[model samples]
Target: MSVSDHAMPIGFLTCPGTHPGSPVRRDDAYEHDLQVDALRPALAALGHELVEIDWRSPVEAFADMPLVLVGTPWDYQDAERAFLDQLDTLEAAGHIVCNSSAVVRWNASKTYLRDLERRGVATIPTDWAQAPDISDILFAMEKFGNDTVVAKRQVGAGAEGQSIHHRAKLDPLWCMEQPAMLQPFLPQIQSDGEYSFLFVEAEFSHALRKRAAPGDYRVQSIYGGMEEPFEPSSADRAAAQAVIDAVPFDAPLYARIDMVRGSDGGLLVMEAELIEPFLYPTQGPRLGVMLATAIDRRLCQ
Candidate 1:
């Protein structure tokens, strides 16, 4: 393929840890490379150059790029305000940001699940707390009538600060130190596994089932989880689609609807990952082309 003289540059916002050759790069940083490798070639074919730029870089560094994808800034949760400010700055400069700042702000907090619930999307039962202590955990457990429960940060990703507690193993002094969400621990996460439905430009691209390692509840790759391609039934697909339909904004450039089966045998929204969810391109080989095509359409518009 011949390189175009006027290939447009598209920025992919990554974190220092996911940047190539960073000393503090994460163990799972390979996922960043995999995502870039999948999209780069396809973008090149469309005369768009995919440039990996660290999200923390000076705002001026992004001036040349007219479009930016909120790629893998996996540590954003640790410095969420700064990360969001950067995206807002980019948008103010007239740059197109995939899953725009508005979407980012809405999805930054897990509380967005409440919005989905109000909009008629089925979500796991959760209790919101400013900072949950043992009492809060006990209350949530009692409300859900489950002996085991999961506690997670309201603003978090990759299950970084997540913990599971059981009545038998409860600790009196333990608490989630930040704003938290408490939910009954679903056995389905271990038995049937979690499902991820990948969408590009609001269209279903692929689906996968993610299973955690033995004795673990998190299905993230860093937690020793594995994924297998899944062909969802029509009902399952519609369930996932309902989440997309409920999103208040126009369809984002990309969305990952993570779900788990409930005790009632229906899927519940785990998260509607709009910010920087790993698209699992390996399982969805068409992801690169699908995204590139979507980007091209956006550019044309």
Candidate 2:
């Protein structure tokens, strides 16, 4: 209840220079770096210390801190096995990860899509294939029977491995060794755009409308896209909740739900970002305070 009672310093782990030679690439944009700078002062105002650490650091470095929040570690997600192994080791040794390793493992993969699908949540139909052949693509094309399709790497952000293709240009081997997820491209993304809703500790915070610039579906700033504030309708809020509830949240943290309405005009999950998502704090100025308070409350328990 008091500031002194909840003053354990919070450290944010991110990938600093994770990719040395490719600084200009989408993964190395320093979005997490900027968030650390923005949230620190706000957390400090609540008598909490905010620390930023490179994700590559050994587990012992974070053992002293009760909460080690993951910022952006794009590379970590790409090779999730190693990253998760490290977190598992830390947890085994009594270190704490905000949101916990359990949540991280579940939310890290797009495979969670199946879990949601089983729960009766309508999602873009996904097929996980590794180095699939032309026949594989053709089969998916027939199954979907949709005019357009999107092929994306199983693990990525900011649309790093997304490709839009018609039946004539279907290339299943495009993914190489990495597993890929295929989905019918929703035309609404080009017309109405995608909706990104931010949630801090299971509570709806705010939403943003991300429109691809011209002919892009990535909708990230790096791709020359734009974002505007949006207040989600109740249906949108319910959709966000449904996705969040599907994930087991053992620890307190913020989440971002990137979604688009399907052909039936029902919302479907694009991705559930728990690790590190651009909070757009500038759009929701009160977000930092809200996040700090949520951390304070959770830690005090």
Candidate 3:
């Protein structure tokens, strides 16, 4: 397919809090700029224009866009239902929502891991609970036979509302305020770090390893975590691909498969970030070109 002669505009959806000019913008909002810088020129090279728009903007504002990429709406977790509704509305109006609303919904909750596990994708052992209390945590610890456990909200991002508790330090009053997933804490996180495999249109793009700060276990940049380009062994790459294949849906426009090495020396799916995952353009320099090419192909189709 040939590139269009005219520069068609593509929508890159962000939230008000992540917009550059927002008074309440997040400190990590610079990630939005980095991604834009990476993709804007590449899209322009393909005779396409990238428009940064707040996702909460009126529906009419997106009428002219042929495709909308679910970009950095980091605040979407706070209003997940509304976010999903907006995507459904845009898709219904004939704008191609990359990853699509269905994909977003399937991925909105961490429980999707269960689906993948059912499809034979290896995942960390997790106990799902509704607003787990101290008793539940203890049950998870006993079930996994591990003294340390990590508890995270079923619907959250960037390590928000996450906690780590050791058997010795267990707080009797501690309890999750929302539906949560409890898993034994793998000490490998501090040693080997977590690996991220990026895919565009289900094709591999690049890989990176994210390590937490000295005293933190969260690998998100907001927690002072750092990442570097990584060359994955073919076996490890295949492990990540298995996750994509198990997605139970058509290929999304982009995906970030985050994994960690399990005790048995195999990678376990940590999270399959299909919605608004930071692509780590710095680690994957060709990300823009690959994504632009894929988007152009989709547009041509």
Candidate 4:
């Protein structure tokens, strides 16, 4: 009924029970969405109140808020449909949302990478296959021309629903019952590290490179992944801009363009995280300020 029930500054939408801290190492890297801590002070300094809104919370709870920032809805992968429904609720209520709900819906799945490629965005070679009757799914390995292939659910985050196989039949029991993406395992991940370029509305905020712990291919904190600040080369920056140009939407309020070295000895888009990504603003407070400024500008709109 009010723009903000009590003049709430901003809503940091996240999943229920997700807190600020590093992820716990499991089979896959669990949620390490602790950037809120870094963001709180910056948002507060900007005369904005930072409130955590669980994605599962009733829309009415944050209904009156002026702007809602989709910062850490990491668990949305587990209940992607429900998450989209919540977005619908916000839009129906007419709340200004960052990374527009339309964009989130489009990016809810990794298939967007293919869409990017269709528009001239360089991306990792991905082979998609439905798991139904996939008796010898390992054929995907041959298609990618790699003895080792990485397999994952089309809509997953961090490293969940991912597996590495060495030409083994996609055992119906071993894989999730859903469409999956298969790509040649890039060995450069261990050496050069996976690259992430962070941006706030077309402006480069910062970049970080992630290296998996020994014996792991997944570069997420829970997988023992290490993070270090990185400076993008002119070529690397251009590659990131190309993906931004190919975004299905006009632009994302905040973007994390992930890339890995391809088998051809060049960088390829690993993902263009739009919905809910770990921005690692905690690496520096300025990153938080950059995000805060972006959110403030959107709210003013």
Candidate 5:
């Protein structure tokens, strides 16, 4: 496809800033992803234009674009209801969201793991409590039967509300009005690392292993985490495929299946990232071309 043949521009969403936003906080460790640089040239090669749009801005800002890819609105968790509402408005207004609004809303919270488990998809044992109290925390401990526990806000990222401690340190007063999910602190996250399978148009494209920084358990850059290319085993691919098969949407534009090996030596879903996950790697030949090709095909259809 030539530039002239590509008649539509892509709106790649980014974190929104405050009105005359404050300067970056000194202690803020957020590493803004630079996928745009790779995406622009790659998209241009496929004859599609790329534009960055603040997801916090009014939907009218980019509603005119043919495709609005939810690139990495990492802050959407801050105002989840409003964010999902915005997606509703965009889809209702005839804008095509790459992963679709339904998928976004469902994937917004970590509770999706429960749904996956019910559907027979292998998922790590997780227990959720709404506006939890002390009793709820205690129950999760007894239920998971683990000495150390990992508790996280239902809708959070970058280890924002993650607390790892012995059952004694858990404060039921922690999450106010917001729900939370609890899991056993899997040692493999530090030893074996988490496997992430990237899929485009529901087709597996690449895979990587994200390892947390030494002495840390959160595998995000903010926590000094690092990732390296990984080759998924046959069983690993099957596990990811099963997660894909559980999606209600026709065919997802993109997906990241994050999982780890449980004590019994089986892949268990750690978390499924269908909304705004950074899809490209820092070192490898980028996946932008594959993404651009997918976008082009969708447009032509």
Candidate 6:
């Protein structure tokens, strides 16, 4: 197909269709599909087709599409080997995959925290151990010397596998047997809130400041957090840019940098979501348009 024709047929790979946070089997995902339906027309208006595919589809089917945007491959993280093998096969067969598979693999594990730490990005003090030992937990408690800390699965998403516990309340036996991350809970997560920087291609698309409504620490909207449009300050913009530039893999078609303030009032990295992050289109009016344009460019390439 010609470049123009190719631009008209961009494929949007999302999860099997359904409502987000609904009770559904992981193997038969539908929530992501439902979201893509809403996002489809926005991309379609820009002159591109949005093709939805299930994880069960053969990778070869997408080889001819100009771009395969990974909209909501939530299941891909858990089954990395299968997911990555498909991506590899597709790329080798000359297909373009947005939010590059390499980046997906790296970010899926959440262990990327260590990689970023090595790069000098300020992050919460963290320790990870598999099936943690009670003694190890005790040691970590003493090591960090924080009264309260967060215990969560290594690959947790959307507050899944997350729990807050005081040192006295924690069970050392539970720590010894689960793959988890232990880190001091930031009181600032309740104070100043978190900043999520959204980017489309290399441009700073928009940003939002998220804060839990009251008596909560999770800033996810699903957890009743409130998000307000934020105009990143010059310093904030620079900080966001630094992170974008630091991405070791290809620039993702989309990314959201989640950061928070520390006790000392300095910014600390919370999470770098290159996968399917909730882009608040209502808050950031022009972002959808900007993102559509970028997708068009990728499709035509």
How well does each candidate superpose onto the true structure, as a TM-score? 0.95, 0.88, 0.97, 0.86, 0.87, 0.85
Put down candidate 4 lDDT per residue, 42-135, tens digits, no spaces. Answer: 7777677888776777877985677888877667777778888888788779887777889998887888888999999888878887762333
| Model 2 residue pairs with clashes | none
Error of 1 at 210 (Å): 0.6
CA displacement after TM-score superposition, residue 286 of candidate 5 (Å):
5.6
lDDT, candidate 6, equals 0.73
Lowest lDDT 10-mer window, candidate 1?
Answer: 1-10
lDDT of 1 at 2: 43
Counted clashes in each candidate structure: 0, 0, 0, 1, 0, 10
Off by over 4 Å in 5: 1-6, 17-33, 58-60, 167-177, 283-286
Q: Which of candidates 2 and 3 is the stronger one according to TM-score?
A: 3
Candidate 2 Cα errors over 4 Å, as ranges: 18-30, 168-175, 249-252
Higher-TM-score candidate among 3 and 5?
3
Report the Cα lDDT for residue 35, model 1: 95
lDDT of 6 by residue, 192-255 (tens): 8999988887688788899997988999767899887788888878777777767777678888
Global fold similarity of model 5 (TM-score): 0.87
The count of residue-pair clashes in candidate 5 stands at 0
* lDDT, candidates in the order shown: 0.92, 0.75, 0.92, 0.76, 0.77, 0.73
lDDT score for candidate 1 against the true structure: 0.92
Ranking by TM-score: 3, 1, 2, 5, 4, 6
Q: In angstroms, how far off is 296's CA in candidate 2?
A: 0.9
